[model samples]
Target: MNEPLAERVRPKTLEDYISQHHLVGSKGSLTHQIKKGIIPSLILWGPPGTGKTTLANIIAEESKRPFYVLSAINSGVKDIREVIDKAKQSGGLFTSKNPILFIDEIHRFSKSQQDSLLGAVEKGWVTLIGATTENPSFEVIPALLSRCQVYILNAFDKSDLEALLKRAISKDKWLQSKKIVLKETEALLRLSGGDGRKLLNIFELVINSEASDAVIITDQLVLDKVQKNTVLYDKTGEQHYDIVSAFIKSIRGSDPNAAVYWLARMIEGGEDVKFIARRMLIAASEDIGLANPTALVIANSTFQSVSTIGYPEARIILSQCAIYLATSPKSNASYMAIGKAQQKVKETGDLSVPLPLRNALTKLMKDLGYGKDYQYAHDFTNNFVASEYLPEELSGTSFYVPGNNQRENALKTFLKNRWKEKYDF
Candidate 1:
């Protein structure tokens, strides 16, 4: 029988699951816990096709616990109650072996629906395993989240996707029977966009269409087939990542033309406009920091305006911000500086605060020379004093490096004049 490709290739165990090594790897905390037969209610947070549902099944199977599956989209409070009742009938409250209730797209469940599961989860009638593409902090209620451990599942890397493809070709009964030769995989990976299911579906489509015994797949053939199928922009799928990547890269490259093109692609694809706006706000600070100080302010205001006035009109606001950021003078000096400083902090363990800079709220602190030798900048010339603020271990450590932009250049000049010996321009 020809079952759906995703169903046919679904992983049955943690060992068979591709990617998510951080969760299932030898040293993984979750793996260790599951191996010890200590299962905790967990919320698997990740993008689609990262094996959230598959992992949930593996956890249930490996734990040797009864598994009950529910979809938030179709299941209601009544359905939840039935499952809870069944779980309670099968296992007592104090028993260690409770049924694992797997809820797919848990974020789609209304508050009342989620509330229904609370009692079962708390009473140990069911060990809830919820999967969400959205951030659980925003979607899942605090009470529910507190009871469940949240584990982040990252997108599959190139190697992980390759491994999945190889497995499908060699292991799948139907694919093994066919004579399939992989000439190139660029289009396959590009079309799948890190989705294992989509990759296999595309592979099925190409292989099924081939008439020759020794079928060869090429980039051009894959593109032609996919394009013929309309290649619709799935807001939750490939187009989402692709468009966002293009949009951010355009801003980073300072190409207004490319930025607008990508922005239009996202808009046409019906992307969440606010998501695009939020990315712009981040780019302003991370990419255009110090170079154009006003960029962040503008991006933030644009986000607010777009949120208030959504869609058809919101596109205009997004375009304005996108173009402005693309054309603005760019510098990542502030971003790089913070990164370097953080690395240094990690390398050299936390140093004690300098005595002069320490708070002198109590008598003991005052006696210990806290704030005693500190030179008040307000009492000095130009409201600036050449005083050591860093600990003795890091007396003159420099962190902020001004960029080549006009504003930073002016800042550099003023700092050089204020502290001739310490501030090097």
Candidate 2:
């Protein structure tokens, strides 16, 4: 009863686990491996409360291996070494029964800490099962990442959350003593933001606050009971995502005032400085694009500056870049171009490259007429030549259209003069 309801109701076996069917289902990616006890080192990457930690526990339990746990938030190289030494002594190094070391929030580990894991994972001394709420490609070191397979754990859907509530109601003695009826779940589901653990926490809070023995769960009751002040700012929860989204949208909408307000909210909430900078880096190219190519340069510089000078000083750099990006001419032309091009590739499959465009580096390639009749732009007038670069099937196709802005209008003019009516520019 002292423990949190989530821990008490935590899935004990793979059968009891909920959601992530792609990983734990009969034909899931990890199904056969767990069954055979030939588990590989892997990083479970997903959103918070999606059972990444739970999956790691289940894998170790089902495989019947010695399970060791550490948190990246507090553990360091010394802690890692101690755990590895223990695993080797108890489970035997380079054996089939090597221990499983689960590190929660593995993304929080610094490069040196992650480096410490390399030896243990590579030597088969331990099978590292890391749980991260962030992208492993960005947070994990390359050496460690290469040694482990990354499995994605998706967010819990409506049914998954509902099932969790139902299971908790039936399994927990405390909840069973009261006649609790789930009359409505929208508030719980919405408030949890697709997080199964959060859903249970909110459910337990509502149930415990009730004065009567009988409790009927309704949207209004749930919403009213849950603290409305929670929206102030949460760096790891729904508010974290919401605030960042608002910040990005404000920049794209060309409102510096609103953008700075959201940026300040994130800064006050102690958001990772690099995370904020990275999002701006993306927005620079995605929102500003060719309309103002300089925005990307400024955003990139901001990322590097903040990364070096963190927090108190970084806030100044972030504000400067955010305002510059907001005031810049906005355009999603570059973003749309890649999306349209990718769609075309998917639709066309692998179309053959025209012989003229093919590289004729080898003698055999030249014999096959590679690079034949390929127009050299410098050989023609104005250092430009008209030619069909796309596959013959997609002749004259245009994926990029210049945005309606001062810079891009000049591009439109240049392209118009060169292609004439070919691209209908």
Quote the lDDT for 298 in model 2. Answer: 99
Top TM-score model = 2
Each model's total of backbone clashes:
0, 0
Instruction: Estimate the overall C-alpha local distance difference test score of candidate 2.
Output: 0.92
Model 1: per-residue Cα lDDT over 338-375, one tens digit each: 99889888988898888888889999989989889888
Q: Rate the local accuracy (lDDT) of all candidates.
A: 0.87, 0.92
TM value for model 1: 0.83
Residue 167 of model 2 has an lDDT of 97
For model 2, how does the per-residue alpha-carbon lDDT over 1-425 read when each residue is reduced to its tens digit?
88889989999899999999899899999999998889999999988999988888888889899999999989999999999999999864756789999999999999999999998899999999999988899899999999999999988888999999999999998988999989999989988988888888899999889999899999999989997635667777778889999999999999999999999999999999999999999999999999999999999999999989998999999999999999999889999999999999999999999999999999999999999999999999999999878899988888998899999999999999999999956
Q: Among all windows of ten consecutive residues in candidate 1, which has the lowest summed lDDT?
A: 229-238
> Per-residue lDDT for 139 in model 1?
80
Q: After superposition, how far is residue 216 of candidate 1 from its true place, in Å?
A: 4.6
Question: Can you list the residue pairs that collide in candidate 1?
Answer: none
**Pairs that clash in candidate 2:** none
